[model samples]
Target chain A: MTPPILELSGLTKSYTAGGAAVAHVVGGVSLKVGRGETYGLVGESGSGKSTIGRLSLRLVEADAGTIRFGGIDLRALSGRELKRLRRRMQIIFQDPFSSLDPRVRIGTALAEPIRLHRLRRGAEVDQRVEELLATVGLSPAHRHRYPHEFSGGPRQRIAIARALAVEPELIVCDEAVSALDVSIQAQILNLLEDLQRDLGVSYLFISHDLGVVRHMAARIGVLYAGRLVEEGPAETIFADPRHPYTRMLLAAAPRLFAGPGAAPRTEIAGAPPSPFDLPPGCAFASRCPFAEARCRTEAPGPDSYRDAGRRAACWRSAELPPQAAEESTARMSPAFRRRLDLLHTARREALA
Target chain B: MSETPPAQDADTSAPVLSIRDLTVRFGQAAPVLDGIDLDIGRGELLCVVGESGSGKSVTALAAMGLLPPAAQISATRMMLGDKAGDVDLAGLGERQLERLRGNRMAMVFQEPMTSLNPVMTIGRQIAEPLIRHHGLDAGEARTRALEMLRQVHVPAPEQRYAQYPHQLSGGLRQRVMIAMALVCRPALLIADEPTTALDVTIQSQILRLIDELRAELDTAVMFITHDLAVVSEIADRVAVIYAGRIVEEGRRAQIFEDPQHPYTLSLFASMPRLVAEDVSGGGRLAPIGGQVPAPGNMPAGCRFAPRCPFAVTRCMAEVPPLAAPAGSAGDGHRVACWRAPLEETLG
Candidate 1:
């Protein structure tokens, strides 16, 4: 059995505010992505989803915790070793316009990475650039075009092509398709899925859009105020969400159909609390309709649920109103639970 | 086939605003907008839906007499109707147009962060239109501003009125923009992608607020957006635009359930629904290949012909006139296609 491609143990990232005190943007968190597996990290703004993605690739230095790739501890890697590792772990940014250099042509942008990685050079580099461009559905003729010449969708394709230039094993896509139109977003998602299947690349896809995540991700982790509140298989999370925070997020998501003749929408009542001053207990306790006095005082620790492989940080998950828990929990029978537990235990032991 | 009511049926007496045979060209070049005709009845929310560079925004700007001097806008008739008597908005003098700008026809623009005056207090911003358009005193204007904020469902109107644009959230700022636009109770409101910058939950709130305001004020609305779902929610009727021309116009239900134009079908198919596995086979996406052609060099025939699966020699040779969809609800549903959908036979 192979070790997970990327693993984080008790990762914590804190930032010092203007005053005397330090603020923990991301509290102690732990998650991992295996080789060729897509892990989705979902959260609202300021949830530290983006920060965790950055921390994984060492884009932002984590305050404390261990991030290991294969057998190597990323934190312990020095200058040269770190440089080598960067080629294997790449990141796609949120804004294509800002991420890309305005002055450089698409070909030049794609070539720079290959040159940095020393993958190829001379005519070989030029030929590789054209091939990469064609791979992302852009014609080789578009290599000379600047960022402004292309629309949002094409610009994203160019970004993807640039990410693939070095042939990285893992790419952290941060809100990669959020800004594009709905139709265009589907195209980009499909492209990413196809690329993943063909290239066997792992992705730490970070976004607030759950629909996109559900379609592409096998496992999903819900983050809030830098802490991992819930982590489970995408279908189980969507079908029978045990965590109150996860339920709230699912409820808040705008649905397609709702009223008579109109589609139902997932409407959230209030906004998330500011990250600077988070509440004790659950980060979502303030907005939780079912919050009790105990909820405000004690933060629930992560616990395995109906499926031993599924984990959620919530006190009253089993106590969820009948209808809310009916569909998902009903599907999780004893036989399925035993199977998932056996599979996960084997995978964990192999990693250890 | 049954026909849904036209968007203009709400006001059978006359349209609040109407444009006929409108042609707009920049300099001596070919017309960017060619013979676009539309009507906005009193209290009707008619969304002009299109992608970027589709001239939906341009149409609204033209209605407001805001086109550049270089744009040669010539329409056989562009009328703004009310009980006072319809006026030719296209023919109005600059001073007359200025008077009508914020008084009778107000617009809530996209990107409220930039559209709003950064330095002005929310109260003062909302009061500006009341004072200037209604000739109210500053004290009275401020009072009216508070009322406007309340009307738009801004919580704690008094405190919010004193806050600046930068201090408000994206949703709140858009609401402030709405309050400013509606303070004078304009007969018509033009919102250009007003909620595009907001989150989904916030977008719905804004849409619901707009729906409520339109009902209360009996104000006509011309909403411009690319989100078809939003159009389905708020628009009584929708006009599908491409390359500066309206390719189709129909009642909301008719447009959604039985679209006539190939482009319209493609646009709906392209949108990713909230739930996966509902429509469009698993892993199969319905994205339109290729980019929108540069508006400056639009194609001679149907602008959508290049991407249309049903394109033919005739479609490439000449422009298709906007006509009633075959077997559709009378003139209520219109399409600009050489061939409409054969769904009845195929399905």
Candidate 2:
């Protein structure tokens, strides 16, 4: 297997707000992003998923741990060296409306990144900006427009164009498509997939939406209370999650169209333990339906199970209540399916 | 939980609230919502599904008589309850509307933090409605507020009652919001993307809570959301809104099983499947090209015609009336598309 583009081991971070107790937002979390791979990091709000995304890019300095990007230890790099390395990594925020400067034209936003990185000069920089606009499926005419002039989708496109201007090797997309509507989300997802295929770029795809994460990533990592609970192939994890938290997430997620045989999702009644005072044991034990006595007293490390490629941090990973094996179908009508088929054809022809 | 909450089977004849030919515009500009019609059935959940700028929220605000004074609003027949207890929301004055609002109908918005007063205790915030609308005294209102909080499943209701909005977590705060909205047990409840700001885990629970509350209170619910999954999860009936118009309406089964409108079809196509693979192979969704038409830039004919793949000359030149197709099951499923029965016409 090829080496991962980004790797973190024993990543830890803490924040003390308003002279209160220090909260370990991320604690000893370890993960990797392989070259030309989309690694999905998914968890609910305050689960440290976003923290990991920022830490990987050195946007926030970790209190302790090692960050290796393409075999270079990021912690050892000086400010100048780190600034040079920033060219290879970019981050896209959730809100496109607030991310860009409203007064700045889209052209200036795209050009600034290229010029700052010194990737291009005068006319070449402008030319590259136009190319980027085209790359994200926008027109060069849109260059003159301000952020307010563009809609959510176009603004997001501009954000993407700016990210690509420096030709980053890996991009951390933190809930990138969560803000847009469904159709626009599809467009952005498709565009990202296309860009990955064409540019051979990697993405550290962070989102709370499992459907979006599953759509983007080949492998998935589930985080809970700043800890890595499970990591595996998307299909395997989605089909049969070893970690109880992972299963809870799947059950909570609403299917677009559910068939009659679909299993009822098992809901976790209480909220996650407070980040400031997380219990010593597994962070999900309180919510786990099959939690054993040891789960509350002893913390479990990320242990391999099912296969070497799959891992779950659970004491009772071996013995849990069996899941209803019914594969929920879309319950799609033949009539509806035909229209979808027609849509694919029409869209293809339109592209042609 | 298992979805389809048994769809309360609300009676059509005596709907809790009904609006016909509702049109809304802002200060001489183009109409934001034009000729909108909807019916909130007694004890049934009707989801108004549309993207941003599609006027779903505007429709709700107009119904509640909450639209700004500068806004121009007109409707042929907008009333609550079909029988002798009917209240004409369109013709009512602000003072009359205020009395009818919390007493007859109430609305919940996306963010509880914005609507909820941070300075006020959770208990007091909830008690305000009871005091103002029901004339409940201080002691009675306080007791009722705590009871309301407990009903929405907030833990340790007594402890929570004393705390302010900022002290509670988002889920608990939202439970507070629901408690405040339903404190009066109003006949009609309009929740506009109430769960959109929350996580999926919290979102489903809130949806279930709302579903449970609607059934218990027998309040007609107009649940507005952009998510098709959430819509299918909780809706008894579905209304597809596009560019300020109802393009389709149907029962949950009818809408999911046999969608007819091109926009609905496109929305279904656009959704990312939860399963391992879908039509475009893994991870890819079929995007509907272009955006929802901005207000002033709306097409003269069909609003969706510009982005629609099936757009024809007739579609661009004239608006198609929303009506049931010839072979459709008795009036339940309707579509506003010139080229519907698409398999026969286009295939």
Candidate 3:
């Protein structure tokens, strides 16, 4: 098997609060993304998913962890070496509006990275910018326009183009398409997938929306209060979520289409505990329905489930039944089903 | 507490709020909301679903008489029903509307932090409506405010009542907003993307709370949102607005089961499916081709034609009126399109 493109071990980060106590934001998170593989990290706000993403790129330094890219320890590298390594890993933020400079022209923003990396020089830089724009489905003519001139979808395309300009092997997309409308979100997701397939770029896709992560990621990790509760193949995790928190998240997400007489969605009982005041045991113990006395007293480490590749941080994962697949069945009303089927068929025909 | 009769049972025939030929425009620009006709029955949750520039929020604001002074609002009939009777909200004076705003009708905005008064305690904010509208004393209003907070299921109602908006979490702040909006038990409630800013778990809980309150108090709700999944969960009826016009309006079941308008169908197709396999096989999401036209530069005919897959030359030349499709379930199901059923037209 080919080596993983990026790997981290025992990553931990904390910030001092007030004058004395420390707030653990990312605690002992370790994961890997293979070449051209998307590793999705999903959790509620303050789950430390974003912190982990930033830590991998050294945007936020880890208190204790070993981050390796292509078998080189990032922390051990000198400033010069790390600067060169940055060209291989870039990040696309959630808000395209704020991520790009308001005054900079779209072409200049795309060209700046190319020039910084010395990827191109002189007249070739403008040509490269136009090519990047076209790669992301924007016209070459759009290069002259400013960031504010484009809409949300186009602006996001520009951001993606800028990220691609550096030709990074790994791009950390933190809620990359969450701000756009649903239709526009689909376009951006498709563009990301196409870029990954064509350019062979791995993504550390971090988002709060599980549905989108499931669509874009090959492997998934469920984070709760700065800790990874589950990690496995996206298909396996969605099919048989062992951790109670994973199950609750899957159930909590609203389905695009529900059956004519589907049951009401189940919601997790309470908000996530603050990272500043985490419990001694499982971070999700307060809200876990199946939590036992031991769960509140002792934290559970990642344990292998039925599958060797699947791991969950729940003592009862071995005993828990597989999730009911009823949620996946296309359970639209007959009339609605017929209409959607027709629409899908028509769409496929048009695309073909 | 006075034994108030069930609000839903009072008038089954008359709608809680009704509007016809409603139009709104800013300064000299094109109209943002054009000829929007809507009706919300007592206790009914009518979700106005649309994209950002589709005028869903504008409709809600216009109905509440909350549009800015520079904006022009005109409607043939804009009636709002409450305990007193039906009042013409469109023609009412600012002073009269001020009396009706928080008394007969109330609104919950997308951001609770911005809507809430930062300096004021939650108790004072909630009690303001009860005291000013219902003529309750401050002490009595405070007691009722605490009860309202408890009803919204805010933990530690006593403590939360005295705390300011900044002290509460997003979910809790939204609950306070809900409690405040319902304190007066206004016949109408306009919630503009109330849960869009919240997480899924919190969003579902808030949705459940709103559903329960709607049933318990029988309040007519105008829920404006861009999410179809949310609309499916909460709406009894849905109106799909596109470029300042309602392209389709129908019962929730009817609309979801058999969406007639191309824009509605496109939205459903564009949404990422929960199941990975469903999304994986498709090469690209079947997104509508173009962006929604800006208000000032709207097309002469169908506003959605530029992005419509089934658009014809006729579609670009003439605007379609909202009418019942030929073989749809009932008059309640209406579509504004040159091509009513896409399957037939596209084929």
For candidate 2, give the lDDT of residue A337: 72
* Model 3 lDDT per residue over A1-352, tens place: 1368899888999999898778889888888898898999999888898899889999889999899998889999888999999999989888888779988888888999899989999999999998998999999989888998988899999999998998999999999988899889988998998889999999999999887888888899999888889999987888888999889888777665552566656655788988678898888888988889989999997653446588898878888877774355366556555555666665666668
Candidate 2 stretches with Cα past 4 Å from truth are A18-20, A259-261, A304-306, A321-327, B1-13, B82-84, B274-276, B280-283
Compared with the true structure, the alpha-carbon lDDT of candidate 2 equals 0.86
Between prediction 1 and prediction 3, the one with superior TM-score is 3
Error of 1 at A329 (Å): 24
True contacts kept of each: 0.23, 0.64, 0.45
Better of 1 and 2 by DockQ: 2
Q: Could you tell me which 10 consecutive residues in candidate 3 chain B have the lowest summed lDDT?
A: B1-10
Best by TM-score: 2
lDDT of 1 by residue, B273-303 (tens): 4225432233355566666677566778988
Ranking by TM-score: 2, 3, 1
**Interface Cα RMSD in Å, per prediction:** 13.6, 2.4, 4.7
Q: What's each prediction's TM-score?
A: 0.89, 0.97, 0.96
Tell me the deviation in Å of residue A26 in model 3.
Answer: 1.0
Candidate 2, residue B134: lDDT: 88
Q: Which is the better candidate, 1 or 3, if ranked by lDDT?
A: 3
Enumerate residue pairs that collide in model 3.
Answer: none
> Candidate 1 at residue A35, lDDT?
83
Residue-level lDDT for B124 in candidate 2: 93
Instruction: Give per-residue CA lDDT, model 2, range B147-170, as digits (tens).
Output: 999899999999999999999988
- How do the residues A125-200 of candidate 2 rate in per-residue lDDT, one tens digit apiece? 9899999999999999999999999878888999999899999999999999999999999999999999999999
